[model samples]
Target: MSSTHAVNKTIQEINEKIKKGTAVVLNAEEMIDVVRKKGKVQAAKDVDVVTTGTFSPMCSSGVLFNIGQTMPPTIKTSHVWLNGVPCYGGLAAVDSYLGATEPAEDDPLNKVYPGQFKYGGSHVIEDLVRGKVVHLRATAYGTDCYPRRELSRDITLADLPEALLLNPRNCYQNYNCAVNLTSRLIYTYMGPLKPNAKNANYATAGQISPLFNDPYLKTIGLGTKIFIGGAQGYVLGAGTQHVANPERNERGIPLSGAGTLMLKGDLKKMDERYLRGVSVVGYGTSLCVGVGIPIPILNEEMAWFTGVSDEDIDMPVKDYGYDYPNRLPRILKHAKFSELVSGEIELDGKKVPTVPLTSYTRSLEIANELKKWISEGSFTLTEAQEEIPSN
Candidate 1:
């Protein structure tokens, strides 16, 4: 081979650039373009950009080349690890049931009722009051590789990550707001299609009033409790959302971040829902008292990675640092989206592209640094910089 043949390949150069902080991230197409420019005939290109940010709710931001999308490259796939297990991240149906009903008085005793019965809904049961639900869908892209629906028992108040617990009062306040909103949306605003599973007299629409007319309702076997139950799968789905906040921003303008993620399956059972509202709403409250972690701030002393004894979670969010708070979630979301869009887990180095994200999530309550970096394509390694020797 000629002496000129002894040159470095493009990918190797790019990897070195990444390691040295020259390039933030590069996708397949861009990597190809960079390789071609290197004057190398067959340089390898393995890295793929998970996605990009079009517009973000966090301080208005967008990518230059991709003018219209919410995030760049439109995050095709994402992954996350929950409880030490790597799971693909995408849009899963985050739902909760209104609860079951029993026979009520005034109605004649029927086979379903026990002597003029006392009717109740799932939410009415104090034991099932916790709302943190898990919605894991077995898909082709999950880290496990095999297809299976994996879910966590009910998520208790203790299961919360501290980033959410920034200000105990504010965290609680946020929880209340989220819970109240959930109660109103799921119960009052969202009604059952058919009342009593029938369309007959007194059945204009079976509502929650039979119990106490409480807007808030919970599901049985769906509370923040632990139960070893098997999971099932159903149809796959997709969705999108955009909003313009008028009360906060000075522009009085409508800014939005619109993107899509795949929902692996329908809610075959209560055990497979995200229980999103409940989880966010009850973070630091009495609901999560002693079982798991608490709401966390973007940065806090108690928050660190798994090996970092200063904290509890094996992979705490603070490890990623505040600069990347959203990194983990973004990666997980991307992995899920990729599976939805392509039907498999995308690779990033030896990992499944998602391991980093999940690992990062467990790093701290939130990595504001990672979040900013992904959403805005910018982040300052302030913590690391502070520790660096000042020359």
Candidate 2:
């Protein structure tokens, strides 16, 4: 055969192999019908609750935590556990599981779950993490800005067991994620900590570090380490110091408090527009900001203690608490639970190690569908085709 013909034959063989590889990996689980994406628990029963499909954001949920200060200036610690574990542990757990090999038992976060199917709470995992329970407080001319007592909580993986046997068929069908914040430092860009300062916050370095100094803070950074969330400056507004003149008194202008001073450098980042607000935690001695994700606000005392920078993506805060906060409660008692496990693995009196249908698997299947959709649109690595149904 001619050299050209031989080359063409070799090319054909290579193309055939590529097609075979893409066809299917028999070992990998295949999904049939699933709904992927985040959603809210719309209704509740005993075993499972319903939520909107990925196409809707009405019920999407996220979380945040305050790591800026050791103790918030004026905040309180109220209900600690809200269905899940501490904010820091949650992040660490998810990252660990995603990066783990067969989910090792040695991982510190592995003990967070009581059983494979149980949800995590602060009471079970607080002892394993480095954190404190203190109240935070701050004042605007001696007046409290926002007041809400909260408990700063954390947790680890020894908390959940069911993760190993994740429902496969419908894994991505519906969204069910638990996000957490850790010492992972996100980078930020800002002019300086103090306004009109000739020197930068870090004279030698231009960037802020991700680690906070607080013992509760999990990640550790050096040199350029800056905490993620914390209040930097007092809102400043100035008025006449003394109205000694009779004309000033007649005008009803006795004087104004020091002008509100907002630190111009750092900006707080939140998940949605609704989560723009600050809360007092650590028993009312600290202040940290929280967004709509319903993450705990770390007291400013902690933020300052950690030397967090405002430019970090993890610390974005909405101005004037102008945005709405996540209204979803940590645990909606009204949520329904379908497919309640009978512990015997028997759905209607048949012995089985596992059930065929599971919400978790359905959620994963949905995610795969969305991935296919992205690839189909030629927006990803997959060949161009058509959009997959996200609903």
User: What TM-score does each of the candidates earn?
Assistant: 0.17, 0.18
What number of clashing residue pairs does each candidate have, in the order they appear? Answer: 60, 124
Off by over 4 Å in 1: 1-44, 48-255, 266-360, 363-391
Task: Tell me the tens digit of each residue's lDDT in model 2 across 51-82.
Answer: 11111111111222332223344332222232
Alpha-carbon deviation at 333 in model 1, angstroms: 26
Global lDDT of model 2: 0.19
